[model samples]
Target: MANELTISGRIVSVLPLQTGTSKSGHSWQKQEYILDTGGQYPKKVCFSLFGDSITKFPLQVGQDVTVSIDIESREWNNKWYTEVRAWNVTYASQQPQLQAQPPVAQPVPPQPQPAPQPQATGELPF
Candidate 1:
């Protein structure tokens, strides 16, 4: 909901929580995690959960989960940075999980080709 991007994958890494204070004297905490979408060409995405929600995400490496995140990009000092901010996290659904079936498309069987017959050279040399 609300233009959120949801992705499902197994947790590959969980970085330690980071705590800091804002310039306005407000404390903040953030936790980052990496998820791997296993397939022929596996992809890994790093996302972070901020604020009190960090405690809600008790994810561990090798656990399958679906996460809702917002992609953000900002420019600072003429440099651009991108962030994937996670808002919601839950266990992947039980129905037809990504790991339950093959990721690659099914192989197609080759069709039989006709063999070429020998050419009659010099009447087959009788």
Candidate 2:
């Protein structure tokens, strides 16, 4: 079975860290990003990026892109949580062409109206 999932969303935030003990108690770097999927409402997903992958998916806030992720579900504190681990991300600019958008109609300007002329001071000409 394939352990990969794909999702498209905007990058909301990115956090970089360097605090993990190795066998010799050495610190290692870590990076992650939060993606906001614009669905019926909206959904946010967090994923970890490591080493070269982090550089491959250089994220910026409000950037729209597609991510190829690995998903894992775990139970913690009597609640289930889902994590999206991104393996590859493709920038939107590299994607193929989509259909062209319809042209927008320009708004019509209001026509000028003639000023009303005042009637001669209550006089009936015979």
Candidate 3:
């Protein structure tokens, strides 16, 4: 199956680690990033990078990158929170050969319809 979301955007900001303890009694480190996709209104999507993915990408501000993300929604304390988890991310400059998609197939033309026939007018005989 195709990965849920693959978006190309520029990295706007990267947040420092906020230390917290998970329910499993393990320490968790969270880092958030703001990505601008250059839409009608530039979107700033927050992504969480943890462990090795953080070290692998080494996010920096003002870098153009494409992210393979998983979107998730959760309800906490009667409030909903959305998150974009980056499973794969790469610098745009590195993949110049894989830039564009092939053209989409055009739709076929509709067939012509037959003309409507007029009803015969006659004296009523019920």
Measured with C-alpha atoms, the lDDT of residue 17 in candidate 2 is 51
Backbone clashes in model 1, listed as residue pairs: none
Could you give the C-alpha RMSD of every candidate to the true structure, in order shown? 15.6, 12.5, 17.1
Better of 2 and 3 by TM-score: 3
Model 1 Cα shift for residue 112 (angstroms): 68
Per-residue lDDT tens digits for candidate 3, residues 32-121, read: 898889879888778888766787887777788889888889999999988888888878765343246899999999999987565567
TM-score, every prediction? 0.69, 0.58, 0.66
Query: Could you arrange the candidates by lDDT from highest to lowest?
Result: 1, 3, 2
Prediction-by-prediction clash tally: 0, 0, 0
lDDT, each prediction = 0.85, 0.77, 0.80
Candidate 2 residues 26-84, lDDT tens each?
Answer: 65666788888998999988887766676677777767888988888999999998866
Task: Report the CA-based lDDT of candidate 1 relative to the real structure.
Answer: 0.85
- Candidate 2 versus truth, CA RMSD in Å, comes to 12.5
Instruction: Give the better candidate number (1 or 3) by TM-score.
Output: 1
Best by the lDDT measure: 1
What would you estimate as the lDDT of candidate 2?
0.77
Which residue segments of model 1 deviate by more than 4 Å? 93-126
